[model samples]
Every structure is written in C-alpha cells, then in structure tokens.
Target: MADQIRPKWALVAHGGAGAISRGQLSPEQEVAYRDAMAVAADAGAAVLRAGGSAMDAVEAAIHLLEDDPLFNAGRGAAFTAEGRNELDASIMDGATLGAGAVAGVTTTRHPISAARAVIEGSTHVMLGGEGADAFARSQGLEQVDPSYFFTERRWLALEKGLARLGLPIPARPTGAPQDLSGKAALVHEEGKYGTVGVVALDAHGDVAAGTSTGGSSAKRWGRVGDSPIIGAGTYASNKGCAVSCTGAGEYFIRLGVAHEICALVRHKGLSLQAAADQVIQGELTALGGDGGVICVAPDGQMAWSFNTPGMYRARIADGEPLVVGVYKDET
Candidate 1:
C-alpha cells in the first residue's frame, strides 16, 4: 500500500497600515488587488503543503506583493521627499531565531533577498544605509535601475504629502523646482493609504515572518524605521507564533509590537487572537499609537489586528482560504 500523507498549514499577509478606505479605491482596483493577493496566498500554501519551511512559504508569498505596483514596496515603492527610492526589508525564522535585514539600499532589485543574504552570510543581525547596499553587491544579488521604483501614483503622493504639511518641494540641482503642490494635495488630501507584510506557519509547525516596504513617502535621508528591524516590524517563534506589522513605524518600534505579541502567547498564555488584540487595542492604542498586525500560530490559527480604521490583509487556512481587501473595521 502507498504511504499515507497529509499536511496542514496557514499563511497571512497585509498590504500595509494607514488610513485606507474603500471610498478611496474603485471597485475595479479592489478586485484586482484581491486577485493578486489570492495568487500570493496560493503560492505560499503550495510550499507549505509540500512540507516547505514556514520561512520559505512566507518569502514566496512576499515575492508577489513585492512585485505588485499597487503596494508601496519593492518594484512599486514610493519616492522620498527628495525624490529618491530607498527600500528596507527583513525576515526571521522562529525555529532558529536567525534573522536578516537590509536598509537604505537603492540598487538591489529585491531588498528582502539582501536581508536573506545577511542572515545566511553574517554573524551580525542587521545592516543599514550604504553599507547595506555594498553588502548586497558583495553577495552578488540582482541589481536594478533606481528608476525601476518610479510610479506616477507614488510620485504624486509624495508631492501631496509635502505640500499639505507645508514642506519644501525638493529640487534637483540641475533642474528648476517642479511645481508639485497640486499633486501632493490630490493623493493624500484624505489621508488614506497603507503598507504590506506576511506571517506563516508550515506543516512542521515552524513559524516565519517577513515585511517589505518602500518606506514612508518623501521620508528624509537615512530615516530608517521599523520595517528592517526584526522585533519592531516582524517577529516569529516556533515556540508560539509569527507576526508581521504595518502602521506608525515609530510607535511600533517603541512598543516592540511583534515581539510583545509573541511574548503574550508564550508568557501570558494568550491565544493568537487574544494576544494580537491586546497588543493592537490594549497596548498600542493605550500608548496613543495606531497600527495593525497579521499573525499565525503553529496550530494554523490566524488573526489581523488593527487600531486604525482599516488594514489591507489576507489569510489562507483550512479548506477554504480567503482574502480580505476592505478598509473598514471587520469587527
């Protein structure tokens, strides 16, 4: 008789955290994003079903989001106030506590690949700015034109943010200052948008976490935030669970959101849902911070918690996995 075989696993992903609202996105755009999310979730589920590591599944899922221009990460990243494109990303394995990250890199085609390189190649846990770029080149990772990140939508968004906030329009030394107040005012006049991330558990019950982002629109130089930091933007532990977050990056760093959620499960005996809720509503909100997180436990349970108005998230589990693209509170 053939050997019996079965596998159980789960995956969760988030596009970002911010003032996302359904009113701002058209019905056509919503469906397109949901379709993309489904493809990403399936890619990850296939790896998990084949007995791949949670880390592998999470990374696979994120690759799709990274390539999607609809989200502000990887290929579609937003420009900084100075009209530059710098990206940051990180990945963590709960089983080994092995973590890697890259920040302030402009040439690496995929920032996450550089992060993985860091974990596999170095004794250190983090690398940032130009040093991170040099490391990516040394590792022989693929490179892309910095302009590969340019998107008309993101460019307009940057301008809108600066003008509304009364900041100067960054000008090129060789060119006259471009008029952008109109563009800035148009994209963010309503204060609506967010980021992307993923958390996963494999058949072996191992946990993994990954987060990728283009950084804040028009951010100042060298302003590295939480995305490239393990505990702040992402965390995972096979002993409990895995988590990926998006929101106010500074507050997430201060609260150590991802690690705290895992800790709640390990130390306070909280369920995945309970832990995430406590962190988003009880801790983050209490601290006067706003954001959200997507998480998964070894048992295959998943949760998306947010104190903000909405979180662009998706989950795959059981016989019927589903993607959630709405911007309002699901609760």
Candidate 2:
C-alpha cells in the first residue's frame, strides 16, 4: 500500500499594515514588536500541535494580541474623535461557514470573545454597540469600565489627529460625537498601523480567520470598520483559504478584499500567493488605499502580502519553525 500523506497545519498573524519605515522604529521598538508577533504565533501553533480546531487556534492567538498593549486591538486601541474607545471584532469557522461579529462595543474587554460567543451561542451573525455589550455580559465574558481601555499613547494619537485637521482640542474629553465631515482621519501611523488578526489551518484541514481593531483614530459618529464585517476583513473556507486584513477600513469594506482573494483562488484557479498579491497590490492599490493580508490554504500553504512599507507578521507551517517580520525587507 502507498504511504498516506498526513494532514498538515499552519498559522499566520498580523499586527497592522502601513508605512513602517526603517528610520521610524528604533531597534528596541522593532525587537518588541517582533517578539510580540512570535508570542502570538506560538499561541496558535500550540493549539494546532495539540489537535485543536482552527477556530480555537485563531481565537487563542488573537486573544494574546488583544491583551498585549503593543498591538492596537484591545488594550492598546486608539481613541475616537470623542476621545473614547470603541472596539470591533469578528471570527469565522471555515468548516461550518459560521461567523460572528461585534461592533462599536465600548465595555467588552475582549471583543473577539464576544464575537465567538455570538457564533457558537446565538443564531445572529452580528451584534453592535450597546446591544453587543449586553450580549457579551449575558455570555459571562469579562467586562471592563470604558476607562480600562484608555492608554496615554493612544490619547496622544487622537490629539495629533485633531491637530492635523486644525481642529481645536476639546476642553474636556467627552463621549459626544464630533463633526468630522470634510476632515480626513488618519488610519496609518509610522509605527502603529492599527489592528490585529490571525488565520489558521488545523490538523483536521479546517481553516479559520479573525480580526479585531479599535477602528480609525479620531473617528466620529460611531464609525465601524471592516474588522467586524465578515467578507471585508475576515473570511475562511475549507475549499478556498482563510484571510484576515488590516489597513484602510473604508477601502477594504468597499472592495470586499478578503472575499475577493478567496474568489480569485476558487474560480480563477490562482495559487494562494498569487491571489493575495493581486488583491493587496493590484485591486487595493488601484483604489488608492494601502493595507495587508495574511492567508492560509487548506494544504498548509500560507502567504502574507502588503502594499505598504511594512507589516508586523508571523507564520508557522507544518514542521517549520515560527517566522516573524516587521518590515518589507525582512520578508
């Protein structure tokens, strides 16, 4: 009898995508970001090594990023125009085509956990704002005061955004929405591109993807980004691939970048690498936007592509050691 090939598992993750120029980040800061990516990848790889589902692995990896203040997901989230935190997250199970998402939730400490709860515990695919926070509380997930999400670094970012717009700083930071109609909100920073995501293929050949973010800095009127939108920021399928995106949220949502990559792979018969490159480089670039994606195929093949100066990413495939990178040159 011929020897049967064993199924392989793979994992990939990204912090964000933007102009992470070499001259911008100090050696110490670069080491810190690379170490954080390694830790997140290790968390997911450990689950896959133990025969856990891809869903579990993705969630585990994202949870670590959310907890760490280094990435801009949970604890390190950016502030809105109102100088408050509003989080968004989404998760998908490729084997079952099940997805859950939460948007604009201010009190949920880990929005990704709440998103998973919606997938496994409820029939709804998405929940938003106070309703999402209510559902998260009912699920017994941890809840924190809105102030728990406050970080001085992010506060300064918001102030910088207002300054860029030539808007006067608010006398007191309140939750009231600001009128930002003609003002261009900054999505990318020199060092912090602003979201975190993961994609994983498990021992059973199932794939999963998830994304979490604080939306754009200095955003107003409850702006919700592509991170909580399934086809835009996160997608997974056993027959195609799993993808998670980070970049300009509006362009991502309008372009359906995540699903478009999978469609090109499924219908056009393009390899995972080709599909990802086309979308990140061709489609998104033409739309006058910048971002990045991390994708994993069913057979444990993986690709990470970005149209920016750099992206924080890590990957591990079948019997391979974990690889981490922060700049385009490293890849």
Candidate 3:
C-alpha cells in the first residue's frame, strides 16, 4: 500500500550534522539556513521533475549549495591547521556505479563539479591536491585564488579550534579580511564540522548521491575526511538506495556508513528508513560516533537519521511539498 503512493521522483539533502539543537541559532540565522537549503533542494528536484537523470539532479543541487556561503562546502568552508581551505567532494551514479572524487583541492571553485568531471572525463576514480586542481582547470571549470574561500566566520572558527588544541595559529591567507573584531564568540566547536550533500531518485528510476566539504577545522597533515571517499561519505545503487553521510569522518570511514545502509536495504531487504536508522542510530551510535545522513531510493522512499541534537536537512517528492529540518526533535 505504501509503495502504491510512492512518487516517481524524489530528492533529499543535508548541510552537515553534529551538536545542533533548538536555540542554536537566532531567528535570522535559522531563516537563512532554511532558505538556502530550500533553494538547493528545489534546484535538484526541478531536474528530476523534468525527467533528467538522477546524476544530473544530484549535481545541480550540490552546485547551488556549494556556491552558497551559508553552508560549509565551497566559499564558506572551514580552515585547516595551516589555515588553508582544503576541500573534498565525491559523486556516484547508482545505475552504473560510476563514481568520481577529489581530495584536498585548494583552487577548484566547485569541488562537486570537479568530482563530476572526474567521473565523466577521466579513468581515475579519485584525484588529489595539485593534480585535482589541474584537472579542474583543464576541464575549464572556474578556478579561484586560495583566499577566495576565506570567510571571517570560518577564520574565527579556525582560530578558536587551534587555541583549544594548543596549536599555534598560522598567519592568515593572502587576501584575507583585515579585521577580526568581535567575531570570536560566534565560532563554536559544534559548528566547526560541516558538509553539504544531495541524493536524488529521478523519473527513470535511477539514483545518485554527492557530498562536498571543507573538512574538520584545524586539521593537520593533509588529512582527508570521508566526504571524498566513496562508500564512506557517499554511496548510491539503483538496486536499493543512495546515501550521503555527514559526521565524524573517522567513524564514518570505519563503519562504511553510506555503503552499509545501501547494503542493508539491498541484501537484508530492510526499508530505506530502517536501513538508515540501523546504520546511524544503532551501529554508528554503538561506536560512540555522532552524526547523520540523508537517503533516497529509486522507489521514491526518503529518510534521514542523526544521533546528534540536530541535522540540517530537506526533502521533496513528486506530488508532495518540500520539508526542511534542523533540530533532532523536528524529526
């Protein structure tokens, strides 16, 4: 009976997850976040409504989110221990199991697009550092100076994170904001971890997933998180579902969070929601990790789960209104 009403197309997205809760933001901040998410979700859902491929829809959605400074992806990404913006992203096509990723990209304007470029143009599954940036440039994708990703908010966050770790802060990037006054209180540890991702089920019954991030604040030694790693931060399969995860990268990588959810749905016949809950609520929690995920299936099923106080998420399906969420209780 539930399947009888399933929509032909659906999409879901997340703007990272962690220790978020009610009152975490002021009225203005909440509105900004909600509006940003809606715009991104609508951009993706519009493609599916037009009979576009799931991969196209996923890419379209992430492109918008990556551009917006409200979420941590492209322009507003966090800083590393060296105070540089090192971005990572990945995308997967469920129907073909074709995937592409880029890690530690410092100059690509849109890492998600760089990832898509990899899948469509290259034989390699992943590219990193200067090579990844070079590939994006060769593809004619927009390239920015390293400091284009700088945000006063993120800079403040980096300073606070480093202070807590007793690490000496590096000098600011070349073209950074000159003033840093009165912004220290705004940077909280809980807000330092963030990523943006999307999953879509298109009219052709195909699914796809994509994720992008600036990685953990104040991270050192070229650490790459789960966002750029297939089957960890992102996984999709038309056989069951598509999953994009956000949280502590180490745990997500160990649990193979994204792939495990799809595996449970495909192999154990668990429902999309059940599989998501099992992986995020049960297995991930048992490991003492905190985070969340957004998922969508070709059958139009959609679900999200997070162990933290909140997760920034949204979803849309054919013949249904868009739904946006933040706090855990909003579930």
Query: Each model's TM-score?
Result: 0.89, 0.92, 0.96
Residue 218 in model 3: shift from native, Å?
0.2
lDDT of 2 by residue, 130-189 (tens): 999999999999998776676656677788888998876654344432432211122225
- Tens digits of per-residue lDDT for model 1 on 107-220? 788788788889998787788878988898898988877766666667777888889879887653232234434222223211333456888887776889999888888787
Which stretches of model 3 miss by more than 4 angstroms? 1-4, 178-189
lDDT of 3 by residue, 1-331 (tens): 1667779899999998987777777676677778878999999989999999889999899988887766678977889999999999999999999999999999999999999999989999999999999999999999999887887888878898899999998998989765444322233235658899999998778999999999998889999989999999999999979999999998999999999999999999999999999999999999998799999987788999999888889999999999999888885
How does candidate 1 score on lDDT?
A: 0.78
Q: Rate the local accuracy (lDDT) of all candidates.
A: 0.78, 0.86, 0.89
Answer with 1 or 3, whichever has the higher TM-score.
3
The TM-score between candidate 3 and the true structure equals 0.96
Cα displacement (angstroms), candidate 3, residue 131, comes to 0.5
